[model samples]
Target: MSDNVYQKLMRVQSKLKAPKNQFNKFGNYSYRSCEDILEGLKPLLKEVGAILVINDEVVNIANRFYIKATASFISIDDGEKIISSELAREEEERVKFDLAQLTGSVSSYARKYALNGLFAIDDTKDSDSTNKHDKDNITSLNNENKWTNPKLTDNQIKRLYAIAHSKGVVAEKVKSQVEKQLNKKVEELTKAEYDKVCEAYENIKVANS
Candidate 1:
């Protein structure tokens, strides 16, 4: 019985040290970003013969939009993979930016949490005591307004992808086209924007047919 993937990953995670490289002026505290963790993990991953992959998806459940970030660690020796995911909700108020910025912010947050979960990084202190901004807005109307902008469901995303694929369009190409058209990521699209993407792909399928 060889050592499992979890044990191998724990060995690497034990050697990982992610320093707080970012400072929050509002909260007067230091923190680390997802990039910092990734950077720190690079050499450790190589040493441990593991590969780290991070991915994001937007999910809509019950009319609420959430950014789901997943981090996977794959062992190069035995091809074993371990995955962890974290989700962050999209804010509704649009305090200073548009939907794109909001989605980007949430995506970054989700990624951070996903990495934290994967590496067993201690975030209780940072999140509980230093995250004054998030704590203050925890119950804000912007955060609570779940109905302002509806999101596309998983089925809708699958349908859109299927339509695009049938028309010889790759997922990246479709996502790039949608981003260019709306100046936002496909995951950040509102319900109307998502419908437009579906319609656009439908037109392509019709043309090919």
Candidate 2:
């Protein structure tokens, strides 16, 4: 689509306001948390045929660390919000090296206490999938023996994709090579290994395709 179409949609979205009761308790902010805003906006975006994505980065703060949260909205609208990462960074900086705050938004120092409320799904669940995995563990697209835990998060999937391609061959080709090297096919491998093999192949295909 053209940029003009996108701009027009955003203009319409800007005029759409949140409900009068949209405020959150305790925080005393008239505006909703980013998560809450997204929750409410999701259905509208879908109805209007659009998508939203977020990008985050860390900024140096007087020798300390802070995060910048950018919410990108696409579809019929295109406005964004950038909240202070101070709280998120403070909360994360205090964490010890070994503990896992799986669902916390370290940048905003926001923790997911309960699964209820408007933004619950986006809070803890989303962050967990983004920050918890190592990049090197990704299996190749064709490697049939690489095993992955079923509960891996979305970030893990992306990391796996990166790992699969880092070796110059697609994950599938690498997986196929491994199978050929071992003289066994994916079916010959155990169920535990079956998914791994497929993942390796998928990664390769994703990278090469």
Candidate 3:
């Protein structure tokens, strides 16, 4: 049987190499940004006669906000395509505090995961691991030491604890893990760092469950 566009896309998905080029100070780990994934796909897509498009929507799930992102893979050969959808939660508090930042953050997260699904990438870590939001790179990923980087608020810390307790993990463990890894106090951690703390708890949950 001759290879079709769908099979070509599957081959590209299996071969795509989107490296984790970005670094996270909080977790001391590296992760692939949405941009990194897209950049890596360009030449491969061109080779495979395929194109990738990602779309995002702010949708509600369980009365909470989520970014529903869809990644479409289309082949120039016969126009056959594959689509994948992923959702990333948006914190209501962050939405109220800074809708622009929160939206961009969650959108990138969703889009990254969607693309990951379409391309068969394994992402063991969350978006918080990299702080890589394309639209707000300055506010989140780059300026960890800039005085303008705001620390996690009291409410945000409390929220972390609440989530920890709900998940049957000690809230203090989350804070301590972040603080130890980042070498900063919880109050001194930036908003991005707070997300890393949340990711830590998520890891614990996954490990135990």
Candidate 4:
């Protein structure tokens, strides 16, 4: 791929940061797969003249499988050993790390790493592009999709449950307790706001059904 494209991909990847509790959400988060990291990178891919492709191989270790993502810069020179998807795998927590990396496209934090391996993503768009794919011109398709609505995962829910049950939201301790348990920058959501989000999701489900 062109240096321009590679740079853009790196910028995008660097921006990826995993949430405290990632993936593992029920409802559309699991089945529809909307809040997808790859989907977020669609515009960047088209802009940079690169295509990100993923492949899979099975390992004989029982229920083991390997997934590889290849980011091909269409403009790369033949002799050059351009970035390959094979480099994406990390050993020693190989399964867990690879799985996290592969699914990063769906999770907020992990997507950054995925983009790093796949494209030339630059945060500073002024010098990176050839005036065709400037940052301002690139539309964020991430906002248009249904799955864009992010929610806490099962792990996060459990953490929240534990905090709420253990401390029972004593006046001064709620904030610290939540932050410690959830590992998220938590704020007290007003009952109205919380109810609204829940009701809106419920309405969405009913409408879709």
Instruction: Give each model's whole-structure lDDT.
Output: 0.69, 0.39, 0.66, 0.35
Candidate 2 structure quality by residue, lDDT tens digits, 41-153: 66665665556555556556456554444444444444432112111233212223333442233422222111112122333333322233211121111113233322434
- Which of candidates 2 and 3 is the stronger one according to TM-score? 3
Question: How many residue pairs collide in each prediction?
Answer: 0, 19, 0, 18
lDDT of 3 at 37: 91
Q: Give the range of the ten consecutive residues with the poorest summed lDDT in model 3.
A: 138-147
Candidates by TM-score, descending order: 1, 3, 2, 4
Per residue, candidate 1 scores C-alpha lDDT tens digits across 44-149 of 9887778999898877766876777889999887989999887677444444446666667677777776788788898766632224323211111122433333
Candidate 1: residue pairs that collide: none
lDDT of 3 by residue, 52-127 (tens): 8788776664576556788999877777878888766643234233667766776776787678778888764444
Report the error of model 1 at residue 163, Å. Answer: 54
Kindly state the number of residue pairs that clash in model 2. Answer: 19
TM per candidate comes to 0.60, 0.32, 0.59, 0.30
Q: Is 2 or 4 the stronger prediction by TM-score?
A: 2
TM-score of 4: 0.30
Q: List the residue pairs that clash in candidate 3.
A: none
Candidate 2 residues lying further than 4 Å off, grouped into runs, are 1-12, 20-31, 75-209
Most accurate candidate by lDDT: 1
- Candidate 1 stretches with Cα past 4 Å from truth are 1-3, 127-209
Predicted structure 1, TM vs. truth = 0.60
